[model samples]
Target: MEAFTLSSDFGYVVLVVVATVFLLQWLGIQVVMARKKYEVSYPRMYSDNDDRFNCVQRAHQNTLEVYPTYLILQIFGGLYAPKLGALCGLIWLAGRVAYALGYYTGDPEKRNRGAFGYIGLLTLLVCTVMFGLSLLGFI
Candidate 1:
C-alpha cells in the first residue's frame, strides 16, 4: 500500500477511482450473495432462467467486463489530466449505476439508458493517449 495525499488533482482522481472500484466490488458481492439466495445450496449451480436473477447477474458480469479498462485508464489518465480523469471516473460510475438499475429493475427494451458510460470510457481512452503523449513530450 502506498501513502498518498489528496491535495493534488491526481490524488483527487485517485480517491474517486478507489471509491468507484470499491462500489464495483460491492456490487459484485451483492450479486454473488443474490445468486446464493437463488440457489438451494451455497456454491451451487448457476442458472439464469429467472429474469430477476438474470438481470442482476448480467449487470454484475457486464460491469466486471468493463471494470479493468476503466481502472487502467483512470490510473494512467489521471497522471496527466487529473480533473478530466475524475470527471470521467464519476461519469463512468453514474453510467454503470444507471446501467445496473435499468438492467436489474427497469424495462428490458431500455437497456440503452445505461449506455452513457461509454462516453466516459472514451474520454478516459483519450486521456490515456494524452498521458502517453505527455510522457513522450508530444503534448
Candidate 2:
C-alpha cells in the first residue's frame, strides 16, 4: 500500500472536510437563530417544552448526532475515493439541509421529508468501510 501523499489526494480530503465543516456550522447557526426566533430565552437552557423550540432543537440535535459519523466516513473515504467521496459528502450536506428544513417546519409528521439524507450517509459509510478494509490489507 502506498502512503497517502499529501499532494492532490490529501488536498481533496481537506477540501471536502472544510466544506462539510462549513455546512455543519451553518446548520448550527440556524438552530441558534431558531432559538432566538422562538423566544427560547438564554441562561434557561431548556425550551420550556415549547413545540417550535422542540422542533428546532431536535432538528439541530439530529444533525449533531450524525455529524461525527458523517465526518469520519467522509474524511476516511476521501482518502481512498476522493472524487466520489467529495461528491457523496456534498450529497450528504444537501440531505442534512433537506432534513433540517423538513424538521424545522414545526411539524413532527413532516420531519420524514428530510429522511433522505441517510442514503448519502449510508453510501459514505460503505465507501469508508470498504476502502478502510482494503487499506488494512483485509480486502
Candidate 3:
C-alpha cells in the first residue's frame, strides 16, 4: 500500500483553492443566516431580511449536500490525475458560486442556472469513481 502524499499537481492546488473558497462562502452565508434568524431588524419590503436568511440557509444545505461527494471524488480521482481532478473541481466550484449568488438574490431563473454547478460536481465524482475502479481493476 502506498502512503497518501499531500503534494498534488498544480491543477489540484487550484481545485483545492476553489473548493476552499466555496466552503468559506457557504460558511459565511450560514453565519449571516444564523445572526438574522436570532435578531430582528427594521421593516423593509424587498429586504424582508428573512428571505435572504432563508436563501442562505438553503445554500448552506445545498453545499452540505454536495460537498461530501465532491470530496470523495476529488481525493480518489486526484490520486490518478490531480490536474484533471483540479480542473473538474474548478468548474464545480464556479458553478456553486454562481448558484449561490443567484439563489441569494431570490431569482428562480438564476437558481436554475446554478444547478449546472451540481452537475459539474457530479461529473467530477463520476470521473473520480471511474478512475478508482479502473485502478482497482473493478471496471
Candidate 4:
C-alpha cells in the first residue's frame, strides 16, 4: 500500500483554500439549520418564511449540487497543473462564497457570477483529464 502525496505545485494551495471554503459554507448552513431544527420540530424546521433562512437554504442546496463536480475537477486538475488548478479552485471557492453572501443578502444576480466561476474550474478539470488520458495512452 502506498500513500498519495499531491504534486509539489501551487495548485495544492488552491485545493486547500477551496476545501476550506466548502467546509465553511457547509458548516454555516448546518449550524443555522440545526439551530432552527432544535428550536422547532424537524418537519417544520425549515418552514420559516424569513428571507435569510430561505437564502441560506438555497445557498446550501446550490453548494450540494455543485460541490461534487467541483471536487472531481479539483483533484484531476491538481494532478496535471497543481498550481494552476489550485488557483482556479480557489477562485471558484471565492465565487461560491460571494454567491452565498449575495444570496443571503437577497441579491439574486450575484449567484450568476458565482455560476460563471465554475467555467474556469471545469476547463481546468477537462485539461487535466485529457492530460491524464494522454499520459496513459488512452487518448
Candidate 5:
C-alpha cells in the first residue's frame, strides 16, 4: 500500500470547498438583502412580521447548521477518493442552491427541492467509512 500524502488530485476537493464557501457567502448576502428589504433590524434572527424575510433567513441559517458536517465529511472522504468527493460536494452545493431558492419563495415545503443532496451526503458518509477501513487495513 502507498503511504498517504496530500496530492494534486485533492485540488478538485479544494475547489469544491471553495465553491461551498462562496455559496455560503452568497446565501448570507441574500439574507442581508432580505433583511434590508423587510426591515428586520440587526440582532434579530428572524422577522416576526414578514414571512418572506424569515424564509430567506432560514435558508441561510439551515445551511450554516449543516456546513460543519459537510466539510468534515468531504475533507475526510476526499482523502480516499478526491474526485468522487468533489463530485458529491458539487451535487450537494447544487442541492443547497435549489433549497435556498425554494425557501426564498416563502413556502417551507418547497425546500424539499433540495432533497437530492442526501445522495451526496450518503456517498460522502460511505467514502469516509471506506477511508477509515482502509486506514485500519480492514478493507
Candidate 6:
C-alpha cells in the first residue's frame, strides 16, 4: 500500500481542532475562576451556596459530556467534506461560547442561547453518515 499523507484540504479541520483545545482550556479556566469566586473547594464539583458557580460548572461539564462524540464526528466528517466540517465545528464552538456566557449570567434559562449549536452537530452527524455510506459503496 502507498504511504498515506495528510493533504492540505484537511488544514481547516486541523485548525478547528486546535481552536477547540484552546476553547476547552478557556472553559476550564472559567470553571476554576468560578470556584475561587464562590469559595467552592476542589473536591466539590458544584457550589451549594452559589447557583451561579453551579451554572458555570455545569456549562463546562455538559460540554465535556458531549466532547468525545463531537471530536469523532468532526474528524470523520471532515474526511468527507473538510471545509464544511470545519465550518460546522466553528459553529459548534461559537455555540458553546454563547452557552457558557449565558450560563455565566446566573440564569439557567439563558443557556438556550446556545441551542443553535445543535444545528452544527446535526450537520456533522449527516456528514459522518454520508462518509460511512460512501465507504460502503452506497454513495
Clash counts for all predictions:
0, 0, 0, 3, 0, 0
Candidate 1 or 2, higher TM-score?
2
Best by TM-score: 5
What value of lDDT does candidate 1 attain over all alpha carbons? 0.78
RMSD of 5: 1.4
| TM-score rank order | 5, 6, 2, 1, 4, 3
Maximum-lDDT candidate: 5
Q: Write the per-residue lDDT of candidate 6 for residues 14-72, one digit (tens) a residue.
A: 99989999989999999999888899998999877989999999999999999999999
- For each candidate in turn, the TM-score is 0.82, 0.83, 0.69, 0.71, 0.96, 0.95
The parts of candidate 6 lying over 4 Å away from their true place are: 1-7
Candidate 4 wrong stretches, greater than 4 Å? 1-6, 10-18, 21-45
State candidate 1's TM-score.
Answer: 0.82
Q: Which of the two candidates, 3 or 6, achieves a greater lDDT against the reference?
A: 6
Q: Which 10 residues in a row give candidate 1 its minimum summed lDDT?
A: 40-49
Provide the RMSD of all predictions against the true structure, rounded to 1 decimal. Answer: 4.3, 2.3, 5.1, 4.3, 1.4, 1.7
lDDT tens readout by residue for model 3, 60-137: 667777787777776676666677777767777777777777776755466666666666566667777787787677
Clashing pairs in 1: none
Write the residue-wise lDDT of candidate 5 on 1-139 in tens digits: 7677886889999999999989999999998899899999989998889999999999999999999999999999998899999999999999999999999998999999999997998899899999999899999
- What lDDT does each candidate get? 0.78, 0.76, 0.66, 0.67, 0.94, 0.92
Worst lDDT window (10 residues) for model 4?
38-47
* Candidate 4, 1-139: lDDT as tens digits: 5455666685575556558665666746654764474453444435354555556667777776877787777777777777777777777777777777677665666567567677667777786788688667798
